[model samples]
Target: MNLSLCMIVKNEAATLHKCLSSVANVVDEMVILDTGSSDRTPEIAKSYGAKVHHFRWNNNFSTARNEALKYVKGNWVLVLDADETLTPEIVPQIYSVIQREEYLLINLLRQEVGAEQSPYSLVSRLFRRHPEIQFSRPYHALIDDSVATILAKEPKWQIGYLQGVAILHKGYQKSAIAQGNKYAKAQAAMEQFLAAHPYDAYVCSKLGALYVTTGKINEGIELLKRGVRTSEENYEILYELHYHLGIAYSRLQNPKQASLHYQAAIKLPIYPILKLGAYNNIGNLLKEAGDLKTARKAYEAALKIDDNFAAGHYNLGMTLKAMGLFTDAIACYQKAIKLNPRYAEAYQNLGVVQLKVGNHQASLIAFKNAIALHQEQNPEEAQRLRQGLQEMGLL
Candidate 1:
């Protein structure tokens, strides 16, 4: 089957080449829709022999996506954003799955690069090139609605997902959001769409989470609760709704409600990899409540799903340390540092644990590494650590 890589980009010259390079050998063709790029994004696309089409920016993702779809000549289409790339491990799986006739759409699991908590999510990036398949929603443009319509008309077509992570997306990282006014852009687009689609589960989930993060806890809670009450049983949406509700309640200092929402989120039958955040958050709540044993179990469950999750390892370490298991805490902290070398908090805690165990040399080294990392990521943390160490005659 001929596979086409379809994408909508604007001023993405910095990342377009890397994104395209990852899939160029795997995809039969590349179709890039440039949304008025001032940079060399179009030139970069053409360098890879990609058919580049210009679309005037209208702040509507679905329209741009549909325009890009019009040019896909292959039997299957793989959608990706500029900040995302196909993993080398998934290329063989993609080739294998696209040849199967029973699958109409395949949701690829994506690893959120640099995200500590919920490191994995499923995205409908790969699908058959059906004429009826058009993206919907203005912000998080999705073809799920169109795909659902097609499936209802043709019941034989089945939606399936890859078991392993197929893509790595950096767009959801805090650094990305902090740059490019991305948070503002996302909020404006979703808010506009939510005005019309007041009951849309996807938008409500996305916007509610945004609101909670932006300190509009009450607004976010209202929308998320509305989403749960009105939206159909989309497990992914439901999981996000409850997860964000947990966050909102946690921010409001209501651990009882937070734990309840987190537990509800975890009970959803979505992929365990996608529920890492819920597990981690619930563990944090449990830890704060002095339920160290339960918190340890929660972190263990998260680690069971994704052993490479550094945050899970770090949280487990914290719980172990709180339970006076210093040796195990040190091991868990070391594992977290191995998985994510820049994990400053892990280093900081490791230092504390090492100091507790009378390993003065190791503790000093850990503190130095933690201080260096915190200097770049959190200056206030670095300052506090310096002051504490100085008071203790260690710095």
Candidate 2:
């Protein structure tokens, strides 16, 4: 049950220590392969007692990752990123699975953190270190290709998804400039890879996402739409494609098309965040269309699926408030606050509802809370709140 921690890192000085510290005690050995880091990344890895290897910056992620794999002497390897860390719960789960000889591949859930976070099921953060499990492609490298081959031919190796471990991904932290640069490099590599493998739907879909992130809206939408058309059977890509299309259309103010795509997105087995987002968007569109009842229904449906869904609650409250259902709206806003106490939009909505219902003192408190939260996240929003309060003579 020897577990080796394998990682690929670059200029990750800020987050490298936290990532290493999270899983330092869990693995038998730590192997870090640096792709020409110019920062204190390698030094941090060494400080954490990780055996560091410097590799030339190759555009292909799989190549560097496979090279890191070569240094892993343990029976099982846990692949991680410099921006990711394993949770304490996942450590014991990997150990338990490694104690058994039946399982060859185990998939863990990767939860991306921060304000705009989402979760996805990912494989091979933990798996057997067999020579047959070679990674593939440039970006978003996967070991599943070889594992699938083994499963197809041998039919003896066990493949299962483990709920015990979750990878906390912090790649999208507040450092927008650094994150954008990483994406720029990835986009360049992906473009070169796509030139050789043009029909790769996964790569195309990722490229679309990158374009959308970089504000190339029309190009991103077109790429995503093409990806969906080519891989119609691939529900996963279709889900993402439809979701992003809705986003692009919404930005264009084409509510009709946005609603259609949003509806299509929810039909696929995507993550909860996507599902909730679709629901929220649909509700918003319906509200804008003057279909208040349907909007309420959509929001309620989202809440039924995930009670702690803060956006759903906030949107529902907004809809209810617009319809003059002040008490019900307040309840929804309160529920949103319970789920996410730091939700500034919910507090603002709650304040507005309270003011409408003549609860000036409670409204003032809610407005102040909203202002405090918004000041940290968005000063412009805080200014708007202050303006509203001043207009009401509450400031």
Best by TM-score: 1
Candidate 2: give the clashing pairs. 90-165
lDDT of 1 by residue, 141-255 (tens): 9999999999999999999998788999998788787877877888999999889888888888999988998899999999999999876789999999999999999999999
Q: In candidate 2, what residue range of length 10 has the lowest lDDT sum?
A: 114-123
In candidate 2, clashing pairs total: 1
CA-lDDT, candidates in order: 0.93, 0.81
What are the runs in model 2 whose C-alpha is more than 4 Å off? 99-102, 115-124, 177-180, 269-274, 338-341
- Model 2, span 237-273: residue lDDT tens: 6777777788778777899999999899888875444
TM-scores of the candidates are 0.98, 0.87
Candidate 1 CA-lDDT value: 0.93
